[model samples]
Target: MTDPTYEFSRAITRRPAASITDGLRAEDIGTPDLGRMLASHAHYVETLKKTGAEVIELAPLESYPDAVFVEDTTLCLPQGAVMMRPGAPSRMGEVAEMEPTIRGVYDEVRQIAGPGHIEGGDILVTGREILVGRSDRTDAAGVTELTEIVSDWGHTVREVFTPPGVLHFKTDCSLLDGETILSTKRLDASGCFEGYRVLHVAEGEEAAANSIRFNQFVLAPAGFPRTTEMLRQNGYDVVEIDNVECAKLDGGMSCLSLRF
Candidate 1:
């Protein structure tokens, strides 16, 4: 067994010294919004580091001021990164700004041309298979394109549909390590997600359930005590942190950064 090391002291800097790209624009959220967003961003960055994975920060777009811009979405993963064609038209520019930065992180990066639309939020990597949601942000064509790309990289891609109530699959689902899964109870997926069993979280706790699995670690917001307990009950050492500021602006722990 590994040493607990006093649970988790503030030994590591949770805040990121690096900033996002200049192309990222958070104007729809405004100045006060930026402050709140960055506070969560800092906490989010620190969590990524603890996952034992390396992280790269993207600069905000100075011109596109309204991009709810976060680098993780733009920096799509496993092997070569792919820039998404955002579901929200306002966020489309993020694809371009994110491409080069992601390439800087990985040697090979690809793009999904239109006639197909996809959101970064739709990606969930379960072992060697990648599940992409066929949402308004992502179409069947986009899934086909991604399927080919990932298959070329020696990974499998599966397509799932986002139910009406949920915003996106990732907003309600995530891969926990290689076995367990944290998903918002109902998304209407029957056999689309194969190869492994699933664990579901109720809809009421959707926000808490939709967290990113960094390296092998899970992070949570402070407000949901029940959800926190639920994760712990399932044998996950969840690291809770304050993210009230970003939460108000629709930012969850998963929205913070990308882990490759």
Candidate 2:
């Protein structure tokens, strides 16, 4: 009865490269400082290691500015790993770059061979089912392909909707445990998490919804005090890491790594 959703034995992360300043973003908030991003990434990896999980840190790919966001490349499940087809043309190469590492860890590695596109960020695996959000990055054809692939492995895929202007489905919510979820008010209002126990981040701290529950700790982005206190009061061991630099590139706690 182990929950692969939160309890993971291994994780994969990539160090931020000097070219992270060129990473894609919805807006040009500012360029990410490589030094700061490196320090924060180290803290993130260290936190994962403290959970007793082997953290495989990959070398940076200078040619791909968004390569540090390894989560967008693949979806790791207990049954197998699925390589994603990123809709962002610049990010498509990241899947190939990640295949070798994924194959090294999982014997069964499937891929979304598609004229349609899907990014791992748009998919969420829960205890009951797999929720695939239809975003700019993930389309019907992509979701259909994913459903066909995972159905063979005894998993159900449910198509959902990502709010307008959101970068990814997970940008507004995260699974806290087997049945509980930490989400934003706006997303919860959509009844996307109807059957699960939902906890909303305090108003105006929507970014906090991107936190991840790994083993015994919830790695969350720093600067969201109300959300942090809320999670702690709800009995989660929250580890706040500096996310300023990552956020500049539209990255968050869950975006920085792929856990399994």
Which model scores highest in TM-score?
Answer: 2
Q: Clash number for every model?
A: 16, 0
Model 1 residue 128 CA deviation in Å: 3.8
Per-residue lDDT, model 2, residue 162, is 94
Candidate 2 regions with alpha-carbon error over 4 angstroms: none
Best by lDDT: 2
Error of 2 at 64 (Å): 0.5
| Candidate 1 wrongly placed segments (more than 4 Å) | 1-32, 65-75, 188-195
* lDDT tens digits, residue span 41-117, model 1: 66666676665545565555555543433533453544567777776676677667666556666778787776677
